[model samples]
Target: MCERTVRFSEINEIKEFVSAACRCKFDIDVVSGRIVIDAKSILGMLSLNWNEELRVVYDEQDPHFENVLQKYMTS
Candidate 1:
């Protein structure tokens, strides 16, 4: 598994992130506080408090998704 910290600067970034996540067959989750949301679920992601930084957790790697993650990575 791998993890990264990411922060969305705009709603479109979230959409793009989710789009990339949807392409992966591996499990991906977005963690905020105590809430862990499916990365591919736009609604779940939208419900998150955007003011806080988020943690992305995934069990596998995909080069395309990694590129997308790099766009939003904060740490």
Candidate 2:
């Protein structure tokens, strides 16, 4: 699996991020502490801890996935 730290500072970012995730072919999960939610679900994502860093985890390992991931990746 591939994982990256991410953050969404504004409401629009969450929408865009979830939209991007929905386009992905593989399963994507957002993990924060003990909670993990379906990345493609806007409602599931919104319930996460947006105030802190979270992980974007995916089962696929490819350059295309990496490119798509750039839209949500945080420092």
Q: All candidates' TM-scores? A: 0.96, 0.83
Find the 10 residues in a row with the least total lDDT in model 1.
44-53
The candidate maximizing lDDT is: 1
Error of 2 at 71 (Å): 3.9
Model 2 per-residue lDDT tens digits across residues 1-75:
788998778878888777777777889999999999998899998888786999988888655557756866787
lDDT of 2 at 8: 77
Give the C-alpha lDDT of model 1.
Answer: 0.94
Residue runs of model 2 more than 4 Å from their true location after superposition: 61-65
Could you give candidate 1's per-residue lDDT for residues 1-75 as a string of tens digits?
899999997999999999999999999999999999999999999999865799999999999999999989995
TM match of model 2 to true structure: 0.83
